[model samples]
Target: MTGSLWRRALAEALGTGLLVTVVVGSGIAAAELSPGDTGLQLLENAFATALGLAVLILMLGPVSGAHFNPVVSAVDCWFGQRHGGGLAVRDLAAYVPAQVLGAIAGAVLANLMFGEQAVSWSTSDRSAGHLWIGETVATAGLILLIFSLARSGRSAAAPAAVGAYIGAAYWFTSSTSFANPAVTIGRAFSDTFAGIAPGSVPGFVVFQVIGAVVGAVLVLVLYPTAGDAADEVVVPHTESGVTS
Candidate 1:
C-alpha cells in the first residue's frame, strides 16, 4: 500500500461514486426501456452492473485496492494486519467514510440525472425475513468469492469473477443482491426501481454484517493455511512506481 492515503481515499470515493451511479442510473434506464417486463429490466440492470464493476476494478486497482464496499475493506484490514501486508486500521477508518459519502453523492447524481428530486427518500419497502436472508446469502457469497481469490493468488480474475458472481446473485437471490452496505445506503436516496426504503436499511445492513462474519469464518474453515497476504479487492500494480 505505497500509495498516499489521500490518493487511495480519493480513488475509493471516486470508484464507489461511479459504481453507484452505474447501478442506480442503469436501474432507472432499464425500467424505462423495458416497461412491464420485470425480467428484461433485471437483465439489463445486471449486465450493466457487472460490466461497470469489472471496468472500475481494473481501472482503480492500483490506486486504492478499489475497495468500494465497507465489508471488503474491513476484511482486508483484518487479514492484512494479521499477515503484515494489508490495509492498516487507519486506512480502514479512512476508506469506509469515503466510500459511504461517495455512495450518497452518486445516488444524488443519479436522481438528478433522471430528472428527479435529489434527495427523495425511497418508498420501496424491502423489509421481510426472506429478503433479509437473501441479502445475507448474497453478501456472504460475495465475501467468500473475493477472499478466496485472494487466498489462492487468483486476484487477477476478480474483475470478471466478481462481476459474474454478482450478475448471477441478482437472479438467484430474492432481494436482487444488494450485497454492499455502502450501495444499500446510497440506494435509499433514490425512489426508483433500485432504491431501498430508508426504514429497511438497518436490517439489511445488520444482515450484511452478519454475512461478512459468516464469510470470514468460512474462509478460515475452508482454507485453513491460506496465506494472510490475501489479495486486495483490486489487484495492485507498480508499473509506474505507484502501488496500493
Candidate 2:
C-alpha cells in the first residue's frame, strides 16, 4: 500500500477496534449491571454503542471514511467507481483486512478488560430465518440511509443519523442490527452479551451482502446521480485532506 493508503488503513483499524471495544465492553457492563433484565441490558448496550459510533465517525470519518464495515467499504467502492472517485480495488483490499483485524483485536481487548477469557467463541446461536430477514432489512436500511445522505448533500448529518439508525435497528430488528460483517465476525469471538455464535456469522454476512446490493439498487433508483456523491457517503475525505 502507498503511504496515504497506509495511514487510511491504520485509521480504519484503530477506529474499528475502538468501536468493537465499546460494543463488547458496554455489553459486559450492561449484563453485569442489569443481571437478569435483558431489556435493561440491551438498552445500556444500545445507548453506549450509538454514542460511541457517532463519536468514532466524527473523529475518523475524515480519514478512511470511518468505514469500519466491509459492506460499507465494498458498497462505497462500487458506487465510487461510477465517478472514478471512490475507493479503488486496492484500497478495498487494504481496508477490509484492517477493519477485520481491528474488530478482532477490539473484541479481545473488551474481553480482557472485563476479566473474561479472550477468544472465547460465543455460544449464542442466532440462526433463524426471521433473524436472517432482520439482518437483511437492517443492512439495507443502513446502506440506503448513508448513501442517501450523501446524494442529498446531507453528509454532515451522517454521524448522528447513522448512529441513531443503528440504535433504533437494535430494537426493531430481530438480529439487533449487526449490519456490519466485520463487527459480526468480531463479536463471534466473545461469549458475552454482544457475541454471536461462530456458526451464525456466515449467514449474517450473506444476508448483509444481499441487503447491500438491494440498498445500492435503491440508491440508483432514487438518486440517479448518486454516483457523483459516492465520495461523500459516511463522510467526505480526500487522500491528503483532513476529511472523514
Candidate 3:
C-alpha cells in the first residue's frame, strides 16, 4: 500500500511536470523559434498538449488514476468515477500543488532556457471572448468524452480521446481550450508565452468550475450508475482502485 501510494503521488508529480513542460516550456520555445507569430505558438501548444495528456494518462492511470487535471479529479467525484467521500480532498491536495509547482518550474526553465521575458495577459478582445466560449465547450466536450469512454469500460482509451479532442478543439474552438483549471492557475504564475495574467485566472477558473459542474450533470443524465462505468472486475479492496 505504501509503495502504491508513493507511486501514485510520484506519477502525479511527474505527469504534472510533463504537462507544464509542454505548456509553458513549448510556448517559450515557440516564441523564440518564431517571433510575433503567435499563430504558430497556438499550433505548437495544441500538439504538445495532446502529446502530454496521452503520455501522462498511460503512464499514471494505474496508480494515481492519471488525473493530471484538478477539474478532472473534481468531476470524477460527481461521476462516481472517483470515490466521493474523501478521495476528492486527497486528490485535489496532491494534484493542485503538484501542478502549480510544475508550471512554475516549467516557466523558470523556459525563461532561463529561452530568454523569454515576462509578458502581460494575451488579450481581452474578441479572441479572448472566443476563448471563453471555447473553454466552456471544450471542457464540456472533454468531460462528456471521459464519461462515455468510462461508461463503456474503455477507460483505457480516455487519454487519447481527450488528447485528440483537446488538440482539435484548439483549432475549432474560439478559446484555445484551456480546459484544466489547475493548468490555468499555474499558467497565471508565469508571465511567459502561455501565461494568462493573474487577473484573467479567476474568471477562467469560474468558467471552468461551471463547465465541470455541467459535465457532472451530464454524466448523471447519461450513465447514472457505477456499474455503467465498469464491468464487474474483482478489485483488491478499494472503490475505484483507490484506498481511503
Question: Candidate 1 or 2, higher TM-score?
Answer: 2
lDDT tens digits, residue span 155-226, model 3: 667778878987898788776777877777667655667777777777777777778777767867877764
lDDT tens per residue, model 2, 1-244: 9999999999899988999999999999999999999999999999999999999999988877888999999989998888887789999999999999999999999999999998899999999999999999999999999999999999999999999999999999999999999999999999999999999999999999999999989989998888888888689987874853
Rank ordering of all candidates by TM-score, starting from the highest = 2, 1, 3
Cα error, candidate 2, residue 12 (Å):
0.9
RMSD of each: 2.1, 1.1, 4.6
Candidate 1 has an lDDT of 0.86
- TM-score per prediction, in order, is 0.94, 0.98, 0.79
Candidate that beats the other on lDDT, 2 or 3, i.e. the better one: 2
In terms of lDDT, the best-performing candidate is 2
RMSD of 2: 1.1
Model 3, position 190: C-alpha lDDT score: 56
Residue 164, candidate 3: Cα error in Å is 0.7
Candidate 3, position 128, lDDT? 58
The pairs that clash in candidate 3 are: 131-175
